[model samples]
Target: MSAGPFKVCMLGDFGVGKTSLVSRFVRSTFSDKYMTTVGVKVDSKEVARPGRDPTKLVLWDIAGRNAIDSVSANYLRGASALLIVADGTREASLAAALNLLMQARGLLPNAFAVLAINKFDLLDRWEIAPPTLTQLRRAMTVFETSAAAGSGVEEAFAAIVAGLDP
Candidate 1:
């Protein structure tokens, strides 16, 4: 059976490891250096879930930039879901990611959005407090992940797929 052709967008502030997360998930590779994504890179993968036909996900790894507000409308076209990633090691960017979410909501009001706290491996060095995480939950589905270690990467994608189907 044919399943979606769903379009998923990755959004966040510059240097939040949005590209790294996508690279890890799709390509199974990690890099210590920060390489900015230009425009957008699209990758497709067919995922099989237990009770459903394989779904074709069109993953759009959008570029992270300093001026997220200016490019918000341009990058979110035809998106079925969004993964809003934040660098957990930098607590300040979490708010920036949330603001991006608000902007994204304005653009794609009905699209499914997931709040991913990336770089969990750096938690020991992070300043993010427990209450900040609680505050984040008020907006969307939140997950802690490490692109470097591959923690919660697949599950985050799977959850997004399930949310989209539901």
Candidate 2:
């Protein structure tokens, strides 16, 4: 990995648990209270890789937006990777996540990206079908995560780090 920290932008629809995932990974904590992100919340974590120096990741938790805008595009500037999150319980959020991915790719075609189907703890209520999830996994690196339960949270971050340029 490079000496400088990599900037990772979180892209997803509203209430997709992007903030919760960041909190869980960075602070080893989660909260039930819901707080809307105003602009962007920044956090950092250093992850270790075997046989290589530790790499620092600067996480940018952008406010949820169904569509891309000037403000959102500005937030994605200089991103090295994208952690596209979607709410598993709400299938529409998946569509939103895909849209966000397209926009992000348009801006940063070479940036590494990963999908995180969040809220796995609420899988019983998920509207996304099994076939769709299987298709998604075939298309990209996908992680079923539940920030509330801490399931797959660390693995998701680790996957992002592993996928980045070394």
Candidate 3:
């Protein structure tokens, strides 16, 4: 059966691997090189479930580190969910990601948010210590993910989908 389309937005700091996470989830692929996302990139995929209609998720990967002016607010309009991604190696980037979330919270207060700590594969050498994980969890649902290895990527997306309003 068909399901209604849902919009999901990805917000984070530069080089936080938001694009890589989306690519890994939607295309099942990953790349190490960093590429800046311009304006916004939209991708649609159907999420299958047992005994229920498949949900259509329209993923929006917005540009990182861009000005959070009126234009950025426009991009967040009508988003059903938000994936606030941050580099596990950089605590500052996580703070920046939180700021972005705060900016859109007014517009999407009910929007489900999943805090994805990207690049879990680099956990051994991460600058951000374990304490940060505890702090992040207090804010939202936190997932330690490695897009490069495809670990917890699909599960994270599924968790966000489960949180979305039906």
| Number of colliding residue pairs in each model | 0, 0, 0
What candidate 1 gets wrong by more than 4 Å, as runs, is 66-71
- Which stretch of 10 consecutive residues in model 1 shows the poorest summed lDDT? 65-74
The candidate with the higher lDDT, 1 or 2, is 2
Candidates in order, TM-scores: namely 0.92, 0.97, 0.92
| RMSD of each candidate relative to the true structure | 2.0, 1.0, 2.1
Please identify model 2 stretches exceeding 4 Å from their true place.
none
lDDT of 1: 0.83
TM-score of candidate 1 to 2 decimals: 0.92
Ten contiguous residues with the weakest lDDT in model 2: 1-10
- Tell me, by lDDT, which candidate is best: 2
Q: Which residue pairs overlap in candidate 1's backbone?
A: none
Candidate 2, 1-166: lDDT as tens digits? 4664999999999899999999999998999899999999999999987677888999999999988899999999999999999999999999999999998899999889999999999989999888998999888989999999999998988888888854
Rank list by lDDT: 2, 3, 1
lDDT of each: 0.83, 0.92, 0.85
